[model samples]
Target chain A: MSTVQITRLSMPKWGLSMTEGTVVQWLVEEGTILEQGDEVIEVESEKINNAVESPAPGVLRRQVAKEGDVVPVGGLLGVIADAEVPDSEIDAFVEEFEATFVPEEEEAAGPEPEKVEIGGKSIQYLKMGESDATPLVLIHGFGGDINIWVFNQETLSTERPVYALDLPGHGGSVKDVGSGDLDSFAGIVAGFLDAMGIEKAHLAGHSMGGAVAAAIAIQHPERVASVTLIASAGLGEEINSDYIEGFIAANRRREMKRVLGTLFANPDLVTRQLVNDVLAYKRLDGVDEALRAVADSLFPDGKQANVLDISRIQAPVLVIWGDKDEVVPASHAQNASSGAKVETIENAGHSVQMEAAGKVNRLISGFLDEAES
Target chain B: MARRITFMQAINEALAQEMERDETVVVFGEDNAGGAGAPGEDDAWGGVMGVTKGLYGKYPGRVLDTPISESAFVGAAAGAAASGLRPVAELMFVDFFGVCMDQIYNQAAKFRYMFGGKAVTPMVIRTMFGAGIRAAAQHSQSLYPIFTHIPGLKVVVPSNPYDAKGLMIASIRDDDPVIFFENKVLYSVEGDVPEESYEIPLGEAEYVREGDDVTIVAIGRMVSMAEQAADALEDEGVECEIVDPRTTSPLDEEAIYESVENTGRLVVVDESNPRCSLASDIAALVAQNCFDHLKAAPRMVTAPHTPPPFSPALEDLYVPDPERVAAAVRETLGTSDRARA
Candidate 1:
C-alpha cells in the first residue's frame, strides 16, 4: 500500500481588515474532483462576498466546516486528497489538525493607517508593500475615503508600494474643505506627494477624484507619471444631479439604502453594514458642511462644474467605466483623449472597481506594466 | 481612520478630547497624575491602571492628582461643578463609594432639585468595578446598581471600546451628575474606535445581535458573554436577540419591550448578584409591559446571592459563563436542563 498526499483547504484572508468569514455555501461536495482555480466555496465577510478557489487539484475528501459556520481566517474549511487515501488516514489528519489548531487573535496589531499634517490640515492615508517600483497613489471620489480602495489596494501593492489617501473632506482626514474646488483639491494632492517626498508617481482616481487627477495632470504634469480613471467626472457635462442631492439629503437608514442602491447594478450588494458605515461617516461633525461645500462648488445645478479638456492631458491615461452605471454614464468613456485606452465593464454600476475587482485589477496592472516599460 | 484600541485607551481619549474641547472640563482623582509633589516624574502614574496617563502633560493645570480622601475630592468635584467647572472625579474603586456616598448621592445628585432647578451639577464619577483578576471581595463588586438606584443620577456601563468612548463623552457633556462604571476585566479588550470624538446619547439600547427566538438583555461585560452564548445556541437552531442597555438610569425600556414582544421569550444575563439587580429590574419591566406576548417565564442568569469569592475555582463558578447562559435560555424555551445536570 502507498501513502497518499493531502492538502487542507482553509479560509483565505481576502483583505487587510477581514479577520473571519462565514461559509455561505459549498460549491463542491465530497468525493468530487476539483482542479486548481475552481470555485469550491462561497464566503461572506463584513465588507464583501467572494468565492474561495481551490489551490491544488484533488478529490474532495471531507468538508470539515459546515455551511453557515463562521470560521476564523486560516481555519480549515475542507480537506482535499488523492483518491488512494484511506478514510482512516483522513480522519487522523483532521483530528490532529483540530487538536493543535489555535485561532490567531483577531485583534493582533497590524500596520495601521497613519495621519500627516500638510498645510495645517490633517490627511489620513494607508501605505502597503515595499518595492523600488514607481509608487501608486489612489484618490477616492466625492463622499468617499481610502476605504473605497479596500479591494484593490492590497492586491496592487504586491508588486509595488501603494498609497491610498483620504482627501481633506473624507475618511479620517480633517473635515474642512477649504475651497471645495478642483484647484483646491488638486493642490492638496500635490501637497500630499510633496509631504511624502514622492517626486512623481502613478495616480488612480475614481469619479470626482478623477477630476482632481486630471486637474493635476493638466496644471502640474511634471508630477504625474500616469493616470487611471474609473467612471471619471471631468470628461463629461451631464451628471446625476438626483444622486448628488439624494446623497446629501438622506439621513435615515431607509433613505440611505435607497440612495446607495444607485451605486451598484445589483442592489443586493448594498448590505446593512455598508449603510451603517455611510451613516456613521455622515453623522460626524463638519462632514455635512464639507460635503455640501464640495457639492455646491463642483455640481452647481445638477451639472459638472469643472469639466476638463481631456485632449490636453499630457500623462498616459487609461479610462474604465461600467456599462450600466447610473451615476455617470458609460458614454463619457468616448470623450477620453485619443491616446487613452478605454474599457467598459458589463453588469456593473458606478462602483465598477469593487463590482468587477479582478478584471479592473488586471486591466490596471497591465496598463501600469506597459507604462513602466 | 477607525483603529482598534483597548477599553482603557478609549476612555483616556474621550477625557483628553473633552478637556481639549471645553476648558471648563477638568479631571481630578487619586494618582491621576502621580508624583505630583515628589522629586521624581510628575505624571508617573495616570491612575491605578494609567487610564488617564498622558492628559496631565497635555492640559498642565487641568488634571489634578488628589489624595486618597474620596469624600473631600468628590465633594470638591460637586462644589466645583456647581461653581461652573465640569469636574470628572475618579473614585478609584467603586468599593470606596461608602466614604463618598454623601457627596455623590446627597449633594451632587440632589442639588438641582433642592435649589429650585437653578443648580446644575455637571460632574462625572468614573470608577472601576466587576469581579475578575482575583481582586478579592471588597475590590471587586458590580455596584452600578447602587448608583442606578439613586434619583437624579445617570449611570453608564459601557461594554466595548466604542461604547466606552461615546458614553464617556456624553457623560462629560451632560448637565446632570453621571456615574461611569468600568469593568476591570474588560480594560484590555479591543474594538474599532473612531479617532474623532463622538457622543452616543444616553438611554439607547443597542441590539448587538438580531434574532427571533429569545431576547437576551445584558449589561457591561455580560454583553460579550451573552453574545458568545447566542452564537452557540444558534447551532442548535435557537435564535437569540442580544440587547445592551448602555445606560442603566434612563434605561431604554422601549427597546427592551419591543424586542421581547417580537421574540416572545426573555433571558437576561447579568454579572451582578441575582437579588435586586439590573437583571431583576429588566425582567420585571418586560413582565409588566409584555405579559401577553411572553411564551415562557423570563429567565435570569446571574451570580449567586453571595459576594465574589477569592479562590480561582470558586471565582470561575461565581462569574456567569456562556454555558450557564445557554442553559438558562434553554430553560426558557421549555427544553430539558437534564443534559447539563
Candidate 2:
C-alpha cells in the first residue's frame, strides 16, 4: 500500500505557549471508524484541555501513545489507516516516527508576534504560514487576545498565511481603546493591514470581533476579500450583557471562572490558567476603563447598541454559530443576510471556533478557498 | 507575552520597574552597589545574590550602598518611608533581623497605627529566608514567623518567580511596612513573569494543586516540596490539594478553612521551626474553626526546634522535604504510620 494510506495523529500545539500536552485519554478506541474531524483523544495542556480530532477518515489502526502519557507537539499519538492495513505496518510506522522525531527546536522557533504603532497606539499581531493564497486575518472579541485563534489559526494556516491580532485593551497590545467603538476597532485593523502591507485579505472574527469585521467590510470594501463570522455580533440586537458586565467586574478567580463558563458548552473547560490569564488582563492599568468604555459604547444598558448590515458587503459572507451559544444566541445565525451562508453547530457554545475547532476550521478554510478562487 | 525568568530576576525587575515609575522609590542596603567608591568597576555587587545587580547604573543616586550596619540602614529606611519616600531596604539575611527588631517591629510597624493613621510607612524590607544553600544556622533561618506575630506588620513569602515579582511590586506600593522574604534556594528557580508592572494583592492564597483527599498548606519553599509530594501521592491514589499562603501576616483564613472543610484532612508544611510556626498556626486555625468537617487531627510538618545544620546530610534531613510532606498527608488520611513524623 502507498504511504498515503496511513496518517499519523500527533499532539497539536494549541497556542504560542503550549509546547507539549499530556494524553488525558483516548476518546475513541482502536478499530473504531471515524470521520476526518471526529475527536479521537482528549489532550490537556497547562492552559486548557481540547479534543484531538482524527486527521483522516479511516479506522484507528493503533494507539501509539497511551493514556496519561506526555507527548510533545508533533509527537505521534495514534495511527489511522484502512481496516485491511496490516497491524505490523502501523507498529513499524510508530517506531520509525519516534526514532526520527525531534522535539521542536528553538532555532526553528515560529515567528514571534510583532507589535506596531498603529495611529500612535501599540497593536500586537501574529503572522503565520507563507503561501500563495488569500491571507486570512482573525479578530478576537472583547476580553480576548490572539489566543482565541489557538485552535483555528495553525489548522487553517496550512492553506494560506493567517494573521491573528490582539485588539486594543487585550493581550500584548496597549490598553488604550480610542473611542471604544466598533468603528475604532475596524479602523485599527485596517491600519494593521496597512502596516503589514497587505492590500486585501479575507477576514474572520468572533463575537464582538465579528461586528468589527462586518464594519470593516462595509467601511473598506476595497481592502476585503471575504468575511467569516463565528458566533458573531451585530446581526442581532440582543446580547448577553450580564456576561460582559461579569467579565469586567471579575477580579478574582471564582468570578472570572463563572464569567468564562458562559463561553464554553462544558463549564469544566474553563481551567485555572484560563481564568488567571483573563484576570491578569483585566487587572492591567487601563484595561478596566477600556473595557468599561467599550461596554458603554456598544453594549449599553445590557443591549447591543449598534447593528451593521452585512448584506451591503460585496464580498462572500459565511456566518457560523454554536447552537448552544449563551453569550450570543445561535438563533442570530438566521439573521445573517440572504447572501450569507449561516451554519449553526450543535452542542457548542459562544466559542464555537474552539469547542468545535475541527469543523470550524474546515468550514473556514473551505469558505476562504471558494472566495479566493 | 509572559517571559520566563529566574526568581532573582523577577525581584530585580520589580525593583527596576517601581524605581522607574516613581522617583520617590529608593533602594539601599549593604553591598547594593558593592564596588562603588573603592573598586575599579561600579555596580558590581547587586546585593549578596545580585537581585539588585544592574540598578545602580540605571538609577545612579537612587541605589545607595549603605554602611554594614543593619540598625542604622533599616532604621534609616523606616525614617525615609515616614518622611514621604518609598524605601526598599534589603535586610540581606533575615537572621540579621534581631539587630534591627526595634526599627522594624517597633517604629516602622507602629507608624500608621500609633499616629492615628496620619503616617504612612510605604517601605519594603526585603530579606532572604529558608535553609537550602548550607547557609547554616544564622543565614538559613526562616524568621518570618516572628514578623507575622507582630500587628501592623505585613509578612510576604513568595514561592516562585511570578509571585516574587507581583508581591514585590505590591509590597513596594503598600502604605504599611512590608517584610518580603525570599528563599535562598529559590533564587535560581525560573517561571513565567510578565514584563509589565502588576501587583498580586496581599493575603490571597494560591491553590497550587486541587484535589479532594487532603488539604496541604505549604509556605514559601515548602510549597514546591508539597507539589512534588502531591505528584507522588497521586500515584498512590492519595490526592492532595496544595495551598500557598504567599503572605503569612494577613493570612487568608477562609481559603485554609474552605480547603480543610472540603477534604476533611489537613497537613501544614512549613520550613520554619515547630514552635509558633506557620504550620502550627494553620493547624490550630483549621482545628478550631473547621472542627465539624475534620475526619482526622490536623498534621503539621515543620523543621525541628533546633537550629539548621551545617553539614549537607544533616541539613537535608533538617529541612522538610516531599517525603515528609507526603508522609504527613498519608498520616492525616490514616493510610500511613504516624511515627514517621
Candidate 3:
C-alpha cells in the first residue's frame, strides 16, 4: 500500500459578509471520482446560490456535512482522497483533522472595502492578494457594484492582486456619474488607477463597463495592459431597453426581483437578499439620476449608442459572450476585431461570470498567463 | 464605504443630509447651534450632547438655536411645517414632554385629520430618553408609550446606528408628525452605517436573530440586551428568535403573532417601567392574537414601576440586564421552575 493524500473540502467565503452557508444538495456523492473544477456540491447563502467546484482531482471519501445542514465558513463539508487509501486511514485522517481544526477569527472579521477619492468622487474598491504581478482591475456593469465579482474576485486574486471597484453611482461609491457617457466612465477608471498609483494594469469589465474598458483602451491606451470584456456593450447596436427601464423603475422587492431575473439564465439566482441589495442601492440619494443619465447616454432609442473601433486597441483583447444572453445578444461576438479572441459560453446569461464561474475563471487565468508571457 | 459609526453620529448625518437635499427642511432646538448669542463664540453647544454640532456652520440660517422652551418651539415647528417648511424640532429631553404635550398631541399630530386631510404637517420632534447615565428622575424617561398611544402620531425608537439613520430619514420625509426617540445610553454604541441615505419603512419589524424554541421581542436599547440573552441561551441548546420593532406607533403586529405561533413561547424585553408600557402592550398583543398556539404564558422583563434612580448602583439594578432577560426566557420555557423547585 502507498501513502495517500487527503484533501479537506471546507466551506468557502464567497463574499465579505457571508458567515455561513447551507448545503442544499450534493451533486457528487462519496466514492465519486472528481476532477478539478468539477461541480461538487450546491451551497446557498443569503446573497446567492452557486455550486462549489472541486479544487483537486480525487475520490470523495466522506460527506461530513449533511444536506440541509448549515455550516459556518471554513467548517469542513467533505473529504477527498485517492481511492487506494484504506478506510481505517481515511477515518483517522478525518478524526485528526476535526480534532485540530481551529477557525481563524481574523478571517471571520475579513477586510473592509477601502474607498479612494478620484476627481472629487468617492470610489469604493475591494483589493485581494498581494503580489508584484501586474494587477487586474475589475469594473462592474450598469446598476452593479464590486459585488458582481463575488464569485471570481477571490479566485482570481490567488495568483495576483485583483481590484474590484464600484463605479460612480453604484455600490458605496459616490452616486454622481458625470456626463454618464462612456468617455466619462472610462476617465473615472483611469482616475481610479491614478489614485491607486497603478501606472498600467489589465482591465476586466462587464456590460456597460465593457464599453468603458474599450473606451479606456482607445482614449488612454498607455494606461491599459490588456482588456477582457464579458457580455460587454458597444460591440453592437441592439439592447433590451425593457431591462434597463425596469431596473431603474424598480423600488420594491417584488419589482426589483422581476427586473433582476433578466440578468441570469436561472431566475432563482435573484434571491430576496439580492433584490433587497439592489433596492438599497437604488434608494441612495443620487442613484436614480445617475442611472437614468447613463441609460439615456448609452442606450438611446432601444439601441447601443457607442460602438467601439476595436482595431485601434494596441493591447491583447478577450471578449466573452453568453450564448443565452438576453441583454446583449451572442451574435455581437462576431463584431470583435480579427486580433481579438472571442469565446461564447453556453447555458449562461448576462451574468455568465457568476453562473459559470469555474469555466470563466479558467479561461481568464489561461488568457492572463499567455498575455504575461 | 460602509463604516462603523456611533448612533449619535448617524443622527447628525441624517439631519445634515436631509437639510442638504431639501431646502424646505429646517432644524431648531435649544442650544442646537451651541453659542446662539453668547459672548464666547458662535455655534457654541450644538445641543445637550453634541448630536447637532457642525450643522449650523454648514447650513447657515437653516440650523437654528432656540430658547429652552419645548411648547413654544414645538408649536412653532408645527406652524412652520403646516406653512410649507419641513422642521425638525429637538425637545432636548423626553421627560420634558409635560411642558410641550399640547403642541405635540393636539396641534401637529391632529393637523392632517383636523384639516380634513388637506394639511400635510411634515414635522419631526427629536427627543432623548432612556436611563443609563446617572441622569436621575427628571431627565431620563422612556415616554414612547405616550406618543404611541396617540392616534395621529408616529413614534420611532431605533435600537442601533443603522436603524437610527434610516428611521430618522423616514421621519423627516414623512407627511405626518413623527416623534423620533433617541436612547441616551445608546448614543455612544457603535454599529455599521452606510454613508448614502436610505429609508427603512415604518411599521416593519426586523428579525435580528432567527430561532425556533422561543420568540423574544425587544424595543429600543432593550434589543441589544435581548440579543445578548439569546446568544447565551443558544449555548444551553435553547434557540431564541429575536425581533426589533423599529417603530412603536406603527407596530408590526403580524410579525409578533407569527413568531409567537411558531415558537409557542414569548418573552418581551422593554427598558420602560412595568405598568402600561411597551412590555405590557406587546404581551397583551401576543396573548390576544396567538392564544391558541401559545405553549406558556408570555413573560416581560422590564424596570419596576418607579422613577429612574440617581445612584449608579441603584440604576444598574433598575434597568433590565441580559441576565434578567435570559431568566425570563427560561421562566417561559419552565426550566427556571425546575431550578426553583
Kindly report the fnat of each predicted structure, to 2 decimals.
Answer: 0.18, 0.18, 0.53
Best candidate, lDDT-wise?
A: 2
By TM-score: ranked, best first: 2, 3, 1
Report the lDDT tens digits of candidate 1 across residue range B114-192.
Answer: 9989999999999999998898899888988888899999999999999999899989999999999999999999999
> Mind giving the per-residue lDDT tens digits that candidate 2 earns over B116-200?
9999999999999889798889899988899999999999999999999989998999999999999989999999888888888
lDDT of 3 by residue, B30-116 (tens): 988775454333545688898998888888889888877888999999999999999999999999999999998999989999999
DockQ of each: 0.18, 0.37, 0.36
lDDT of 1 by residue, A1-373 (tens): 4567889899877666778888889998899999875768878777666667676899989999998678998899999999989999999989999999987787656556899998999999999888888989998998988878877887799888899899988888999999999898898899999998898989999999999988898988888889999999998888898998888887655677798889888776665567767867876657878999999999998899988998888889999999989998899999998999999998888988877776788789989999889
Q: Candidate 2: where is the Cα deviation over 4 Å?
A: A1-9, A23-33, A58-108, B1-5, B28-84, B106-120, B133-135, B188-192, B207-217, B223-243, B252-268, B283-301, B311-313, B321-341
lDDT of 3 by residue, A1-373 (tens): 5667888888888888887888889998799999988889989887888888888899988999888677888889998899888888888877997898886564476657999998999889999989999999999999999999998999899888899999888888888888888888888899989988898899999999998999999898888889999999989998999999999988755678788889988888776678767876787767888999989988988888999988889999999988889999989889999999899988898999988888888888889888889
Per-prediction backbone clash count: 0, 0, 4
Quote fnat for model 3.
Answer: 0.53
For candidate 2, write residues A1-373 as lDDT tens digits.
4655989999998887788888888998889999988999999887778899998899998998987677898899999999988888888888899899998963357768999999999999999999877789999998899988888898888889999999998889988888899989999999999998899999999999999999999999999999999999898899998999998888777778899999999888777778877777776557888899999999999989888887899999999999989999998888888999888889999998988888899899888878977
| Worst 10-residue lDDT window, candidate 1 chain A | A267-276
Models 1 onward score TM values of 0.72, 0.85, 0.85
Among the numbered candidates, top TM-score falls to 2
**CA lDDT for candidate 2:** 0.89
Q: List the global CA lDDT of all models.
A: 0.88, 0.89, 0.88
For residue B304, give model 3's deviation from the true position in Å. 5.1
